[model samples]
Target: MSLANIFDTAASAMSANTVRLNTTASNLANAESAASSIDETYRARHPVFAAVRQQVEALSFDTLDAGQTETQGVQVLGIVESDAPLQQRYEPDHPLANEEGYVFYPNVNAVEEMTNMISSSKAYQMNVEVMNSAKTMMQRLLTLGQ
Candidate 1:
């Protein structure tokens, strides 16, 4: 791995964390939403991530290597809805209540979502710090020859 690659890795991590934060916000937004039917109920969502790997380009004779792969960054595979059971409540007087007098709520847990948001934000901040540190190191390297 090269120093420049650190920036790429940190950037990818920040992007993934942004997606995570978005999903957490979405889950929290729909946490209280109620639906009359299972199909209409909103479900908590989460983003899946995978590490991106690439073959390092051989820039010189010394760089040539066999079967060498480096992790470039992170990739967001996709967003998935949680399969946990939805909240079922007996609210007969509720306008959206079903015939059985039960209103279905999203499976989103507010506390969990909040915690996820905090975690994502911290990850993003850490990535930012990483990028800054890389930048500083690069700058110092450039000044060394001056």
Candidate 2:
């Protein structure tokens, strides 16, 4: 890969991490939400990612090979809701309690959601650092020709 491709790869990774952080935040926000029925409860969400293979461009005679593998970068496919069952709590006095003396609550774990958020944020920061480092390296290379 060329030096300039570093920036593209880092940018795509940062975008994917942003999606992850947003989904984590959403999960945390609804962690305490209660529902009268499982169908009405909030479901945990997660971001899906896939590698985007870049199209191979024509190569010059000097560097051309009989066959070459395509390069890939990170990509966010979409967000998916977790299928975990809702937690049932016996809260007869709860306002949203059902006739069976049970209150259906979302399966979102606040601690796990918080952990995911932190990890996603840290990953994004690291990607930023990578892009910055690449920028610095490119600048240094340019100075050599001065």
Candidate 3:
């Protein structure tokens, strides 16, 4: 793949990771929220990603008629809420308790969210490194003429 394509792929991956980090932050922020009803409770959200591909023209003169497909980058399809059951607690004294003295909490798992945050951060860093490496390679190539 060309260096320009490398930059594009890394940028797309970084964008997707940003979305992941945002969703994780949202889930963590609502982890402790309480609601009187199930419908009012927050649900853990996660972003969906898919590979993006594009057709490229054949570079070789021998197979100019043939087309090639390459992965451009990752794309965020959408955010989805977890289907796992919410936490129901019997907190009769709680202000948001329902008629049954139950308060509903989000399905968000703090440990899981924290882990996801760390993973997303690492992925972003890796992309940055990839871009930097590409830049250095391009610079070195330019210096070869001197």
Q: lDDT values of the candidates?
A: 0.91, 0.86, 0.94
> Each model's TM-score, in the order given?
0.90, 0.87, 0.90
- Candidate 2 per-residue C-alpha lDDT over 39-114 given as tens digits, one digit per residue, 9 for 90 to 100: 8989999989998977665455676565443565799888888888889999999999999989888888888898
lDDT of 3 by residue, 1-146 (tens): 77868998999999999999999999999999999999999999999999998866556557657757464999999999999999999999999999999999999999999999999999999999999999999999999999
Clashes of 2: 0
Candidate 1 C-alpha lDDT tens digits along 1-146: 87878988999999999999989988888899999999999999999999898877544446555444365899999999899999999999999999999999999988889999999999999999999999999999999988
lDDT of 3 at 77: 98
Off by over 4 Å in 1: 56-71
Best candidate according to lDDT: 3
